[model samples]
Target: MDKKITNYIIYAVFIVLLFLSTLFKSFSTDVLWPKDQNAKGSFDGIIFSDPQDISGLNVTRTIFKENNKNLVKYDVSFLYEGDFGNLRILGNPVSQIFLPNKMNPVFSDVTLKGEYNKINNALFQENLKLKDLYKKVPDHEFSTTSKIRVPLDKEVPEVKFSMLYEPRQITHGLKGNIAQNAVFVTNARVESFRDTTKQEKGIKNESKNFQESGYYVNSIEVINEKQIKSISFESTLNSIVFIISLATAILLIWLDKNKSQVPLLISMMLSIMTVSRFLDKGATTFGILFIWTITGYLASLLSYAITSEENKIKTRDFKRSIAWTLIFLLVNIIVFIIPRTF
Candidate 1:
């Protein structure tokens, strides 16, 4: 076999192997990026009986820890059609209140207020009072503002909001075998509203009911910027080590192709690979080092095969190359597949 042809074969094999290894490296898990900036969960907008009457709605939330407990405060604003005075807003006691920890029964408090504004009929009704329009005709819009505070036991990575409605009831009763003391109960009657004739006659005769309503701003993510940066830095370090190992392997193999320098160059390559494995125990770094070690050994064996004058020595080098190639394949399988599978 001509020495020039052998040299080309070795270089071509090395280049192909290196290219394939790098292609695999591109898909390795060591590459890192920001993964915490997005929220994950089902977040249907706030529920309403009628969804079309609402012009717009906005909800903004702020989360923080207070008194050893995580708390989220929500500020909500929405525009609706109809008279603000006659709108009766009621929240479902069960679903409207959110608890961070399910064990606690305390319900969060919610407050709401609405402001009135006249629409197109304001010019003709400029002298008319708002109180007089209660029964005449609906010609106004209202902007509502609301706030809610929810308590949580721990910080949530993401938040999902939904509206739920269900029937609930409470009852109290006691039973005992022993005699019990007698108990007495009392009841009181209260009168709430009374209207005067002048007020009733001056009021406009119009329906003041809400026609429709809707909700928006359903989900948000709580991101940890510091943790994302740490992951990115670690990935960058791993990539740098991989690049350095690849370059070193190519240089060492090219140097080892010379007959006189084979022993010294192979020894140096082995020593460097061993030291690198110890320095960085990461799978990516180890895999690169293992690949370079195999290539170095193969290059040394090929050098011996071509340079030796005796037929027996050349045959021995050929057999050794076959054995080393098999061993390299087995080690690569274990390194690349085992860790990723489990």
Candidate 2:
């Protein structure tokens, strides 16, 4: 094959792989919101459930405090069946009963059995900063975790809890569920409310959608009041980062083809991928590049031993070059594990 053609093919392959992986991992590609639909609608709150338990709306239930402008509660119970007995759920701070006056939503109480435990507002705020549970929020408090641990030692792992929140928007009715990580809830009960609520409190059933009762929640809504006129700050920043990453990728590919700086190009591309992952999704731009530059350079020295040209640019070992490049590319693909395979 023509040398130029070979380079272009390699460039195209790398570009496609990186592009798809980034898009798959980046939620910021769309409007900067938690949920998919963007309109003025009251949010019924979102919960990030541990994927191990395979919890969904079918196994979950929700109920709201009967009072308005007070507290909104999520009554949830999970049937644990996974290795990680410690169930972890994080609430997206942007999507719930925030204080009527402030943009903050603080968890007032977390109940496991019947007893409610008080969590410090500051500690919860601090937890959001650490990515141990999830990503770091940019401007202010992003997400909060109100964990209710259901120990495996218990005879029956059927755990129940009521989480109270200040009413920002009234979310009632188990309108629907969103993936294994998130489930939305409303304030009112559904047709199966009686049997479901029998496990907890007595509630009336108004909806017609009936299922064999066992924790069926009612009422979840989306109010189309909060709408964005222009691109948000974070969204704008993400866009910029994306543009930079793409441009840098192109530049690195071009340089690699002409100058044959294989290790340098691979390292930089790896770095851009990490930085583009703003939420620390996997890693960062500089951090990833640094590791790649250091490690790939040191490892790729074998290429020199395979080449006889001492004049640097006099002769090209296209076959050896392709092998080393493919090796690095394959390593990255496997390491990052796309959809996050950047």
Candidate 3:
């Protein structure tokens, strides 16, 4: 019934909310990257298939293959499932192959390979700049697209392809009988010794009006090796961020308990920035970083407003404050950790 008690209750509720936010924001990162290990590899070639003709039948397929190899060559081959009928739907195909980049094992052949080390050094310098940018930017803003090129020739003789059986339960009419599997081919090269264009000639002979496969050959590039480091604090300076956040939290909790608002507000702001480190994993667009930063500040603002409206600090009041705080803490725990369990 006392005004001081009521104020303490409200202050306790907001402080508890802050703790809950801190504890559960990590869950968003989990949702962004699956823990099941479903994604095939950390480094691999990219394979794509499009029912829609967005890449232009042959040109897109060639571009896709080249990018796959240039970025990294997977031990397995890549495949594209073309829709024989429709020619407009264009998007990244299902299944991603992660292979090593050309710079891996970090050693070059002793024999002269025409300034291979110099070229690699230049590339490494460029990669360093990119990595720096990646750290400064929030995780949500990272790009997902991969661009590569692979040379098709004698040494790289056989093209390998992989296919998955689409059960009739889901795609009955589209994929038809289970006996016929979707086919994807990799490492396809036109033989130099044989009549390489024989298939085109045959198709033309049958139709009396046939054109080359409508796919043009572009220059091929190969990625000899590549690397993907584990998700860690080394790159993001996360340890620094974490230290700053914890210090800020402790300092604010102390200052507010002693009846000082300024230090508390400053501490809250720092904690918000600290949490922003994890946002890197989920953002799809550049604008997401801005959004997250704004949300962090907004949370801090709400904390300030709630405390100001309620004059007495929770630490000063004890019992009623603890009860009120527990309600919020319980709610956040239920919302974040409980539902997924069921």
Candidate 4:
């Protein structure tokens, strides 16, 4: 076999192996970025609740990939006519996806699904007043409904709140999302607006809740940098590059009669890119970095050098590649460490 053709075949074979390994890593269930199929084994961020919230409290966030971006659809839940009514999602609203406005967020994705307990608007000839609405509806802890602000003369039926004394399993389907580094915050109070003593309770309670001990806020992380990167450049991008290079190498071996350096150059470039991506993430000790740098540089050089054009080694090129590899590896290590120090 001609040495040039053998080199192309061997390089194609190496890329084929890389493609196979990456295919496994990207598609395996245990690997990262599951539902985001377009970018499997990539950095698709995480959707999680705040650490302080016991059992994630009322926030239920599910992280999935959609349209090549990490989409988080979460149900921000609280008691009926309760905290979530005054909810405010405050943080870095950097995401270009579904984010709720700061004030009047309930209107963003409202789903009114509960009734007022012990209140009958049908019995009254005139529309129920706010006082009647408040006094007639008994307190029940389990009813879940979207908050609706009606005029003082509006009927309880107009509110369409499904309130009851009986316990019902809540399907907190009120969905909301925030971009990376943002939070879902709510100025929810522990008290209900069952106070019928003042007709102004509806207006006053919110202000009171905002000012007093009843003022409480809970935060749920919408998405953050700390999330497990499901699809990363190392895993998915390299896999793609490997596929493209493998195809090119096959074409060169079968069709291109001329001896070309493109195949070997691709192999070397890919090795450097793969090593760079690896060093971009994960904690790497000096030992790991040393082995990785040496392996990456030597493997690429040897892939071409062993089947040299004249069957001789390029010692200067090998040394230069080693020096450049070490420099880049050290630079990556520094870049990785500098951010964590702060």
Candidate 5:
């Protein structure tokens, strides 16, 4: 094959790979907030469950703002099939419930329903009118916990459980600063458990004693009209930065196709990506994209340095660079994207 033809082929492959990386990253669900003006917040979490005992699980979260306060509603549903004697479920601490400063819980309610012996039954239900449960913790922050119990029979082979709750949290100004319209962020930890106590039908036994558990987080966001507008504006600025940086990197490579220039181009790209992290707060997508870009650039630079001349780049150097770049890209996709995507 002609050396020039091989070099062109390598460039074409590089462009395709770059395009695919950008497209995939842009569509990643890791970006919690959408560019849409109506998007108020995002929810994402992993549910760890015993494959042998639990068959399926589903979780949903909803957020609402009323009376100048932000309220979060959570719905957790799951299916289990196993001997009741072997079943165990545990819950994590509900510390994330207190957010946007200390919040006096307007109300904390829990309702649990399940099926036993092929018959629909209300296993456990409770509505705690928690005026006294709400107490100030350290730092003068108010916190509360809701407890519910579901009585189960050991002979039952299959059970489906569903729980729902809504807790109203006060929306204070951003962390330390007080603003008229500030974005409120919080998360909920919902856990599934089985009754392990020898006793039957008690709130303390239901809430306090359990083992072998699975949990998930429901991230809540409450933003007013003005805060939503600010998010939209920031997103626009991020888009502009992304475009300019990408264009500049490509232009530099096209104008000066020398191995010596690769390092400078890579530095410029990294700087732009780092700046992107500040433009959008708490965004992991930018970090992931930056890592991917850096890996590719470093791999190409290494390959070029090993194969190229001091004064000029050759076709073989380009081909070798593409080979190493592809290897690095594969490693990145395996290490980062695979687990997140799956």
Candidate 6:
């Protein structure tokens, strides 16, 4: 057999193996923008009694599951009325209670089945209101819904909110074994009223409870940077990266029909890209920005260099590339450290 032919056969086999390896590898579960199939928004009304009130508090909190399917965006007028109690407002003032105006937008591709606790933990981390630890209610801590003001729209609209509550240290009169030092929210009323030219407060009946069955919001807008355009970019970049890498593989095979190395290189590129893509996805899903950014940058550069047509493999070039890569890695490390330094 000709040596060239044997090399070609070997490369073909290696390429095939690479493809198979990549095919078996698991992809990342991160939601890249618009790919959220289960994205949904809700306007929750939580009614419970203020824990500090003596007149028996009733509170209702509302949260909207802002999903991709829903076209409606939240407005500035959207107000969240917490159960009357001495609750610490995290970043914003109670008087200027607005939805997290600059909060990061989350993709809704993650599921809620069996991972309810994990999902809740993720939400708690992402949401500022939850971080405030608003009055820990004994055993039933999960019952009390934290009111979050999420941005639905840019328009500075005005909305009306009225509540009747008695601020009393709750759980005092409850029977024994009940959760201690409790706060209750009930009878919530949410209305989306428009300002008449005459400045009259119109009555709108859009109130609901948080505990009602089949009632839960999955997404909310917390930031302006989370515009639809940004979401689109994230989705497009992920796709383009994969496609370009695959195309490079195909091109290499075509150009070096007799060289077995071409096929092997293609397959290797595919495997690497697959792994990198999965890692990026996982990072995005878990909110590990530093890892995702650094990994993605490295993967992009390595893919280009490994598959580039300029086939001059000088030992010096290889060392220089390795050095540069290391430098970039160090840069990422420095970036990760800067935040902690402050």
Error of 1 at 66 (Å): 11
Candidate number of the best TM-score: 1
In what order do the candidates fall by TM-score, top score first? 1, 4, 6, 5, 3, 2
Which ten-residue region of model 6 has the weakest summed lDDT?
A: 172-181
Winner on lDDT (5 vs 6)? 5
Estimated TM-score for each candidate: 0.32, 0.26, 0.28, 0.31, 0.29, 0.31
Q: Is candidate 4 or candidate 5 better by lDDT?
A: 5
What is the C-alpha local distance difference test score of candidate 4? Answer: 0.33
Q: lDDT per model, in order?
A: 0.33, 0.34, 0.30, 0.33, 0.34, 0.32
TM-score-better candidate, 4 vs 6? 4
Q: Report model 5's TM-score to 2 decimal places.
A: 0.29
| lDDT (10s digit) by residue, model 3, range 131-188 | 2322222231211222332222223222353211111010111111111011112112
Clashing pairs in 5: 89-193, 90-213
What RMSD, rounded to one decimal, does every model reach? Answer: 23.6, 17.8, 18.4, 19.5, 18.9, 17.2
Off by over 4 Å in 1: 1-8, 11-44, 47-52, 55-58, 64-221, 252-342
lDDT of 3 at 218: 21
**Local accuracy of candidate 4 as per-residue lDDT tens digits, 13-68:** 55454433333222232221112221111111111122222122243434344556
Higher TM-score: candidate 1 or 3? 1
For residue 72, what is the lDDT in candidate 5? 38
Which scores better on TM-score, 2 or 6? 6
Candidate 2 Cα misplacement greater than 4 A, ranges? 20-166, 169-234, 255-342
lDDT tens digits, residue span 1-342, model 5? 643344434444544554444444443322432223111211122222234454444444444345654343333344445443222222222233322222122332322221111110110111112211111111211112123223333344344433222332322111111111111111223344222222222211112211112222222212233443454465567677666655655454444454434553353334334343333332254445564555466436532532233423566756766665565556545654565654
